[model samples]
Target chain A: MTMKRLINDPYDVVEEMVEGYVKAHDRYVKMCDLEEAQGRVVVAKDAGTKDKVGVVIGGGSGHEPLFIGYVGENFADGVVIGNINTSPSPDPCYAAAKAVDNGKGVIYLYGNYAGDVMNFDMGAEKADEEDDIRVETVLVTDDVVSSENIPDRRGIAGDFFVFKAAGAKAAMGADLDAVVAAASKCNDNTRSMGVAMSSATLPSKGGPIFDMEDGDMEIGMGIHGEPGVRRGKIEPADAVIDEIMDPILKDLPYEAGDEVYVLVNSLGATPVLDLHICYRRVAQILEEKGIKVHRALVGPFACSMDMAGMSVTLCKLDDELKELLDYPCDTPYFTQVK
Target chain B: MTMKRLINDPYDVVEEMVEGYVKAHDRYVKMCDLEEAQGRVVVAKDAGTKDKVGVVIGGGSGHEPLFIGYVGENFADGVVIGNINTSPSPDPCYAAAKAVDNGKGVIYLYGNYAGDVMNFDMGAEKADEEDDIRVETVLVTDDVVSSENIPDRRGIAGDFFVFKAAGAKAAMGADLDAVVAAASKCNDNTRSMGVAMSSATLPSKGGPIFDMEDGDMEIGMGIHGEPGVRRGKIEPADAVIDEIMDPILKDLPYEAGDEVYVLVNSLGATPVLDLHICYRRVAQILEEKGIKVHRALVGPFACSMDMAGMSVTLCKLDDELKELLDYPCDTPYFTQVK
Candidate 1:
């Protein structure tokens, strides 16, 4: 198959994307100038100027608007950049900590992947050892089917809500511990599952990362072509969403009368029309279950580069989580106001 | 080739999408309840309350955020939706005008397509004859390569800018004529071109609307699979952008010292990662020409279902155009603040 990507080179994709991103959104963010960080860290233009706990989020590339697109006013203070599906180096991670640290402390938020955990922990240790600055970490494990153990579950679309809650808490002048608590609380309430029709075409690989027949789909697939629960011929929109929602609703046992924020996120290439078709089913199922939807976000919030799939994320909301999720924020990708 | 879409019966795609769209974005918009309109018209919750010219935009259904997503506070007051790649019947268009009119006249804005022209004109006549309400229109023709005559060009991604400027002008208490002029002025200043890597899969057809080989790309392809200037092997991002931008910049004769807004819009399935890569080259070209970029929007602002491609739009900014474009507005797909 043709690569079918608009890129100059495989190796330079990340750097070029960053350069274009900063230039396009210069008002909200800037490239981190720290020598140790270089092209691997993006800091909000107003980072280190506010008197609040710092909020940092990061992971592999290809998930646009996940880590980098969330950096701006009242959102993430800085983001550490990684290569496509690969973790960032330790130096840039440490540099992000130093850049966003406002003397109160810094909190790291990311998905629970082994490579990312190892790298971010090293960065936190470096910050503690060098500057004696306190840093806390919150691992978002919201993908319900990734593992049987709750803490071992992988993060997916739910990372958006977890980060939003944490960012808002920090922006509201909460200290490091409070911010971490908020993120953990949101993650605990959040659940996500996805159905993938095809794998993302990696720039380096020049084609799909994995192979599947054109008319088939994998239920509960991870973002990076990780193993899913079942693979079969693509079903109707309602049937596919029904199967995906079963695990999510069952894992949380989201009972009637619960208020939740709904996110129907495109993995990559799924059209907005299909997503809403899927969201229609989700809304029908939720209405049947008597779950009140506080707000619904439908689009490509978190995506795998050019992958054909989508994920549904629900963060069951309480009063506190509601306020935090609804807090005003100005980022390149997301903006809300009073 | 497999359709690879998640949808139910092909005939119900538009109705199902509208059901989910209004449900998901109920905070900003509500389904128009006129028995004549029903699911075909979406009106802002605050429409007809503000004493200003009613702004209504409409087109086919496949473009999601174009017609429906723009209906919200300080934006298009109502949207008339149609079937995929088809125009709305005159009823919804007339209903949209009736729904948004508040003593002040209504102005219809949309791409300049033959079917749209005939149907909207009929809607305007119906409103005048029945309700004694006046409605004016400014058809957008910004697709630079669509025709040699500027007035006959097709509108594509540049519709976003024209609608934004007119919406803000109307919200600022401009009369119908002023709003129409605003849209026309923005359209005159805007130019766009695109390349397509694949054709969008039509729900009704259960396959691509047109055939495109795996690795071939067509420069300046219209959103609905219209033929472009050239078809050949896909080139590097910079080279492809160079080809697309040449006609846009030269046709406008954009000169040094001109300030303009930039939009690198994804044509459905193109990833955000690839768009910024393309934007990097756009910036480079603008810098070389000494053109100043006021602001840049890079995303899937306008799409063609699941077609894999992108378009670049440039709207030259004067003091008036800049003020209008920068005006605060909140919609589901696009939002800005003072």
Candidate 2:
């Protein structure tokens, strides 16, 4: 199929998208004006006003609402943006730390990806050496099947849980180390797996990043088109959810009498109708296992721009995680109130 | 491409989706227990609790967040759901009125579609005859190119604005007549136009509802595969926005000094990255016209399942409209807080 995106000059997608984003959501965010981070860093309007530890989360650009949309009151304070499916350069990462630092400290949070790790580490070093601003990092690794070694697994939709916990913790005036521990705890309890029916179309490439037969699906696929554990004909929502849920349930060993926060997230192009159908199955499975659902969020929280698929993330909750997850937040794409 | 939806039986999609929706958002909504509307009427958990005019909105099933997701505190008190792309039967409509109505009265709001108009009218009549409860309605007609006469036009993305204004007004303890007036005023001031790059696939048919070359687009397309004004090769985002914005601006004749609320909505498959890109052009054009944007919402507020398209809706705001639009509400899909 021909790539049919509503964009101008494929090469300019990221720059143009950033321009539009800040304009549309001007009340929530503004472009960071540091010379080195002109179009790459988005800072919340209230970023440096509070004495709380600043929360900075970022990664590639295609996943809208992940890094950028979450930057607002009581959420992520700043974001370092990159090109589609690519890590932000070191300068923007460093610039983000500078822009949001409130003299207390700043915590950097994002998915586990090699490029991201290298670039963010460099940014952290610059903050320490040049500016004397303390910064901490917590890598999210929640895609259970990506690696048997949990620390090496790729972060997917579970990034939302970790970021929310950390953001709320920071907003509550937790010190840098306490905030990092809160984020690390959320990451440790979260598990995610996804099934992709089609690959997302790349703007610069002007085609899908990968090819799959129209009726096929890849189970446990990574967000950036990384290989999955299995690829075959599309199955019913229940069958697919069962397949994905088995690994997540077993890996976390989420037992009966345990409570969890459930997220049935659309990767991108999947309709809300389909996501709810999938959510129904997930709820039924949880009920069968006697696992309690504390709260459930269903929609596109994180996306792989225009990819046709969905992912399920379950965060096993203790009292602290539950309180943090339910904390009031206001953002362009997410909002909660007492 | 084959239709790759993650669903069980196509016929059971609506039932299962409702089952999932009520489970996932149980904090805000519940299944209406009227036997006549079982599985069809979704009622807000707080419905009829306050002595204010009841707000009810709904249409078909495919537009996920449109009718269902908007049911919660200070939004629609109840929703009458239908099968995919089909209007609700009169029974469910009457059931919604009965479920939500306080002693004050009830108001019905939905997009302007012939089927919806006929059925909701019948429902209102039934409510008056059988229950002696007063009911009023304000139909939203915002698609600029749907007809020469404004009231005859179909409602598309502009449904969100009209619904919001009415929901807020009713929640502020307005009577039925005042709520209807607020919704009517919003519908009158709103204008919208859309371009579709691909047809939405229908689950029952197991194929695209209509066919077009992958790289082509139709300007001013309706949500449910209705005919659009022009069909040709797809163009850049700016060019397409120009075509859509011209008609909306001319139809509403939004003046240089007017302040408006803008919604750049994805039909379904369009990415958020593209929507913001579209919003940037919309903002640029409005700036050139000297029309100030009061606020902007860019996302899939309404959709045609899996259709690759977007629409821009502009609601010229008066002080009254502005105040009502900004009123706080909490629903599963949309939330705004002071």
Candidate with maximal lDDT? 2
Model 1: how far is B114 from its true place, Å? 0.3
Task: Give the per-residue lDDT of model 2 (tens digit) for B266-295.
Answer: 998899999999999999999999999999
Error of 2 at A11 (Å): 0.9
Interface RMSD of 1: 0.8
What are the per-residue Cα lDDT tens digits for candidate 1 across A1-338? 78788999899999999999999999899988888896899999989889999888999999996878999988899999999999998888899999999899999999999999999999999999998889899999989889999999999999999999999999999989899899999999999999999889998889999998888999999999899999999889999999999888988767789999999999988989999999999999999999999999999988998888999999999999999999999999999885
**Which segments of model 2 are wrong by more than 4 Å?**
none
Instruction: Report per-candidate DockQ.
Output: 0.83, 0.87
In CAPRI terms, model 1 is classed as high
Q: A113 in model 2: Cα distance from truth in Å?
A: 0.4
Per-prediction backbone clash count? 0, 0
lDDT of candidate 1 over B111-178, digit per residue (tens):
99999999999999999999998999999999988999988999998999999999999999988888
How close to the true structure is residue A140 of candidate 1, measured as C-alpha lDDT? 91
Give the RMSD in angstroms, all C-alphas superposed, for model 1.
0.8
